[model samples]
Structure formats: structure tokens, C-alpha cells
Target: MQLTRFTDIGLRIVMRLAVAGEQPSDTTPMTTKDLARELAVPYTHVAKVVGRLAEMGAVHSRRGRAGGLAITDLGREAQIGWLARTLEGPGEVVDCEGSQPCPLRSACRLRGALARAQRAFFDSLDEHTVADLVRDPTGAVLLSLSPPPPAPPTDDAPGNRHLPQHR
Candidate 1:
């Protein structure tokens, strides 16, 4: 079963935040705009996803100068399948009950088969957590997209060279 665009964006947001959280010195929260830019998605789309994630308690958002987005512990430890299901909602894989319903809705074995397939897909995802999505190479790549923390001032700098040593 294919994930909706919303779910896809949601997953990406969580993954990015999870990667950032893993870094001890990367405490700076990411802004929605930053996430949108990094993910190459629309600001509105990212904002909507962020809102949903916040509502679900998977993400935390603060407003103001120090305000930005951060993944909660719940988000970091969230099962992939659970997150997917929450983002995907309770909709069926196929539109078996639409305005113009399928003629074979009553006797379609295909629908049942598709449902099972979808369940299996989610069950597979349940075996992993969001943290599992950003291991090594993937984590490194994601980290590269974030701006590095400011470097500490060195004693060798001209301004600091004349200062008395505290040690």
C-alpha cells in the first residue's frame, strides 16, 4: 500500500528530527520553514504535517525567537507501523465505499486480499522504530543538511590572545 503525501511528509519530518535529536550538540530546534526547505516541500505542507504531529504528541512546537520544532521521546521511539497508521488514518486501501461504489463491492475477493496485503505491509513496519530509519549513512546524510553549530572561540584568536588565562 502506498502512503499518502501527508504521511510521507510526516515520516520525513520525524526522521529528520530524530536524526537531529541523536546529536548531543545539535540542540537547536528546526523551524517549519527550515524543514520545508531542507525537505524541498511546500511550507504549507510542512506546516500542516507539523501541526498534526504536534497534536499526536509526536512533535513539540514552541513559538517565538527560541521557538521551533523538535521530536518528542514518543516520536523518537514511535513504531514505524503505528506512526504510519496514525498518519494514514482509518481509511481502507481501496475506496470500496465511495459515492460511486464498485459494482463488485459485495463479492470482491480482491478487496479482502488488498486489505491483507496492506496489513502485512504495516506489520513489517511495526518491527522498526523511527530511529531505525536514520542509521549510519542515512543519518550522516541527514545531518549534512543541517547547519553546523557555531565553532567555539579559540585562545589563538587575536582578540583572545591578550586575555589572561583562567587556568
Candidate 2:
């Protein structure tokens, strides 16, 4: 019943960028590393989530050292409810589907009720945009965010997860 971390990160990415879109702090577009540091998430995670947001048309990105991210018009106007729903996907709330099978698969009014509730949740979220979430007129939200503790160095770099530890 809880939102997935992916959805959470997706929201954070869009909201952070939308807030930053106002020229808070560094006005230039933020790279994944910058976002990861600002949001207190892993760089790999931010990179992956950024790709998802880009695919969803919530943000745009560039490559190379100059590569960075920026929220799009869609991102700024994104509805939290829609973002949650879209990121949550069309899967069943309680896994009442086949193959694995659920005891309630045959007749589950709970599923219908859950669906209705989910719709209502999104309906409420649709009333607000990403901008609505940022109420700080002084842009304190951007300024107040603190960096996370440093990540322990990992030898498991991309495409090298199978590599033997050199240490």
C-alpha cells in the first residue's frame, strides 16, 4: 500500500528540479551527481530515476561532462497524483491476478474498493501541480535541503558488478 521508492525518487527529482527551475542557488541545470548530493540519494539511483523521468517526459538530460538535468514544462506542471499513479503503474493493488494466484481472485469487492480509493487519491492530487508543493516564496525549500552521509566506496561499478574485489 506504500509508494515504491522509485515513485518517491521520481517525485523528488521533479520537485527538486521544479524548485530549482526558479534560479535558486545555481541556476544552471543540475547534473545527476548534483541532484544525488542535494537529494541525499545514491548517484546510480538518481541516474536511473532521471532516465525514467526523462522517458516519462518529466525532465530532459544531456550527456558528457557538460551533461545535466532540467525539469521540463511538463515536469513543472506535473500533478503529484498523476505522477504517483503513473509511477505506480497499472498493477493490481493487492495482486489478485493469476499465475501466482490470490484467494480473493474469484470475488474480491476489496479490490474494487481499493481501486475506487486509488482513483480518489489521484483525483485529490490532480488538484495540485509541482509548483503548488513548493510554498516557500523565499526559496527556502531548495536552500534547506541537506546532503546525505557519504556512500562507502564500492568496487561494484556499472558493468563491473561481477568483478572480483581488488582489495
Which numbered prediction scores highest in TM-score against the true structure? 1
Candidate 1 per-residue lDDT, tens place, 61-124, comes to 9999999998999998999999999999997889988999999999999999998999999999
How accurate locally is residue 78 in candidate 1, as Cα lDDT from 0 to 100?
Answer: 96
Model 2, range 1-167, lDDT digits (tens) per residue?
57888889888888888877555456567888888888888889888888888988999999887778888899889888988888878876676775787887678788899888878878888998887887686246775676876677676657657876687
Q: Kindly report which residue stretches of model 1 are placed more than 4 angstroms away from their true locations once superposed.
A: 21-27, 146-167
**Model 2 bad stretches (over 4 Å):** 21-25, 137-139, 149-167
Model 1 residue 59 lDDT score: 97
User: lDDT of each prediction vs. the true structure?
Assistant: 0.90, 0.81
Model 1 Cα shift for residue 26 (angstroms)? 3.3
Best by lDDT: 1
lDDT of 2: 0.81
